[model samples]
Target: MSALWDLPDYDDHEVVHFVRDHASGLSAIIALHSTHLGPAAGGTRFWHYADKTNAVKDVLRLSRGMSYKNAMAGLPMGGGKAVILADEDRTKTPAMLAAFGDAVERLGGRYVTAEDVGISVADMQAVAERTSFVSGLPAEGDNAGGDPGPFTAFGIFLGIQAAAKFKLGRDSMDGVHVAIQGTGSVGGRLARLLAKDGAKLTLADIDADGANDLASELGAEIVSTDEIMQVECDVFSPNALGGVLDDASIAALRSPIVAGGANNQLARPEHGKLLAQREILYAPDYVINAGGIISVASEYFAKTENREVDVAEVRERIAEIPGRLVSIWEEAASSGRTSAEIADARAQELIGRG
Candidate 1:
């Protein structure tokens, strides 16, 4: 109740752990939620959470959300997440990542790790030095070390189109106004895609320079991070950290559709109901941001080539967002439930059979 991960009502199977050094340096957290489907798999974020308990809660909730996301995305993988507490200084040692790899190894393939947050492609390579349980690196090429955020943005772009079609009764992104908060890897690329599609863009980020750069590049207007939720736009995309849509902020949000690449965007389960009450077409963050998972999962199992990531196929999958959102919206309306409740019900129904 106090934390986003501490949802007492959900029947979740979660395992939370803290581990010390693996090779030399690293504080690691592994959260596994395996009962939802199969072995848990998620990303390793290397940022310093304000509180250790918050980090634990984030990993736990993110892992379970991953289970639901993977299930909804029709992936065979379960859900898990790793958070490595780091100082503000990112120029640490490879030993930290190696230690995280050891944590992954301790799971014996039941829990796999990739990259997220403060983790990067280079960090994955460091983890790979100790274990083979990591993914998201492009194959041998000049662009081999590219981040998966662009792909994620691409998928979200497609999903936004799907959302518009289903919720707004529009067919194209020609004049859609989108407010993207946090112009980081995913949000920056999302801004680019929206600009290319002739969509009006309003960008925001804690890093003013980063946001301004992207805004200038994409011809988007810039907004402050604090003003993002209140921006009058067709869609609101949160690409920053989790739990941004708390009660205080939710009341100020003026967007018609809310979707993005952020994990755990909802501050609480009740926020979903708040959105429903406001008639905001909210796409579940987990459901919309499955591209990175799909990419990494393919790498873990099939060793699929990056070029093989068919944009059309990915777009087709993302285009199903509207159908899924519509179903969840309808179910919520009929049952007087939240979209999250409907989504969790559908996910549990699928995983319960397995």
Candidate 2:
């Protein structure tokens, strides 16, 4: 097993906590990558992992990405992330969630938890039941806002448009072929948005039933996961797992642009350079998928003022994603650097000022 402290870029992390509750069968890790701007805030992800090392590494990388994501989104919060290692079907229970919430509360307000991947609004509500360090609750009374998935999908759609304009020199997604991997919450919403805009869709997901249903609803063609990346399309949108843009996968991609909701999409830092070398316009994942965090931050800020979240304001903030991507794309072209590197540098500068 690799030592957590020895991992590359491990020094960049501000704090890390390992929480275990044997009674509830809960084992989790929370990583706070930075708190220069404000308290660390990000989502809690629950997924079964093959080993503890991989889980810890994921939280570390994701938390760091959150730092960049938050900075680029212009949120005052820093970056932190939590991961619960357990089978969603068998080990997830109210007791487990509450235990996890207790762990979050122990961090004080330095870290806030929300919905991500294996976690949902309902699950966040369960976490909220145990502590105040949670968001994404239903809009019941003065509760913190609801799901941010749709907003995230909308942001990605807008970012894709910016990439298309930068690469294809067009302003519309009309008639553009897009292969989307993962038809879950965010991806599903994104597909609907793209289809409504008259974009051709090829959908893929591990959940065959759900993907097929979405495909039928949107008049899209369904492809297996293995074939999704190789599909002939103008854009390859990965809405599922991270590290899908590794050397092997990058070699097989036929798209001229890659933009989607997956965080930490590059397997390694060098992958960004490879994408740039290949002339594939890549929209940095953190910049594109920041709508969710933006929504969460809005709720957090509203709570400070003792008011309900302003959904309209949140939408307006998310609408800035495309413009931000355009700026980053232009800067990368002028600097002859990967978009990811440029984004990281800008984020670092922002964090430095804080």
Candidate 3:
């Protein structure tokens, strides 16, 4: 493994922590990318990384993305992320969660954690047992706690609409062919939304059964995971992991528009330029995937203020995603830059002002 300080993207971050709890076998990394806006707040991703180096790199990138995402979404929170390097299937335990919670508590509010990939609200609840720096709990009374999947999908749906409008010269998704490369929580809900709008759907996932089930429900054609990216479609939505838009896939992609709920869709920054060169309208992933963070921010605000959560306000904020996308699209078109570059510049300006 490369030296932590020598890793790419390490210089800009404020702090990075590696935690180990021998008794509980909990090993994790938490990265705080920025605190110019406020205390860092992002999700706790639990994945069985091949090694500690991969976990560290993933947290660093994800934390940085959260910073930009929060800035672009007009939120007060800064960016941070946590990743536990253990198999969620067999290694997760209550003791392990409490130990992870203790590690978060040590940060003393510098970083707040929520649920991400391989993590659930129940897991957040377990983390909360040891520290108050947690969000995404199950709803009770007026508290808004639950999965952010649907909200995220809603944002992607809005982003897809904006892309459709820009590329197809129409505001509706009617009869538009969209190839979704993951049918998990976010993708499944997104497919339902698109289906309601009369879009033709092509679905694929690593989990064949889940993908097939969703496809049957939505009348979407099921494609193998490998073929989904190269499929003929008007839009290609990636709801799976990152690095799917790397050199090979970008060269093979046939879609006119690329938008999705996944974070870090572009394998490298230059891939954004490549997509632009190919005449693909690319929605910045951080900008499009801000829906979950918006909901989490609202819940955090309500908790801090000791007030009832405002569901309407959350919906209103999410509804603005399309307009934001349109503005970014216009700016990219006028400036002759990729949308990712434009969004990153805008986010940096916001961070600087903070």
Compose the digit string of candidate 3's lDDT tens values, residues 194-284.
Answer: 9999999999999999999999998989999989999999999999998789888988999999999998888889999999999999999
Best by lDDT: 2
44-88: candidate 2 lDDT, tens digit per residue: 998988776778878998999999899889999999999999864
Which parts of model 1 have CA positions greater than 4 angstroms off? 1-14, 140-146, 304-319, 333-335
Q: Estimate each model's TM-score.
A: 0.90, 0.96, 0.97
**Residue-wise C-alpha lDDT for candidate 1, range 1-354, written one tens digit per residue:** 364345552335567777887456677778787645667888888777667666667777787788888888787888788888886675568666677777788777788777788888888888888777777765544322236676678778877887787778889898999999888888888888889999999999999998898888888999888788899999998988988888888789888889888888988788998888888888888777877776666556645332444434544555565567677777776888887777878887777733
**Which candidate would rank higher by lDDT, 1 or 2?**
2
Per-residue lDDT of 341 in model 2: 89
Clashing pairs in model 2? none
- Cα error, residue 51 of model 1, in Å, equals 2.0
Candidate lDDT scores, in order, read 0.77, 0.90, 0.89
Ranking by TM-score: 3, 2, 1
Candidate 3 residue runs with Cα over 4 Å from true position: 88-90, 141-143
In candidate 1, the residue pairs with backbone N, CA or C atoms under 3 Å apart (3 or more residues apart, or in different chains) clash, namely: 40-79
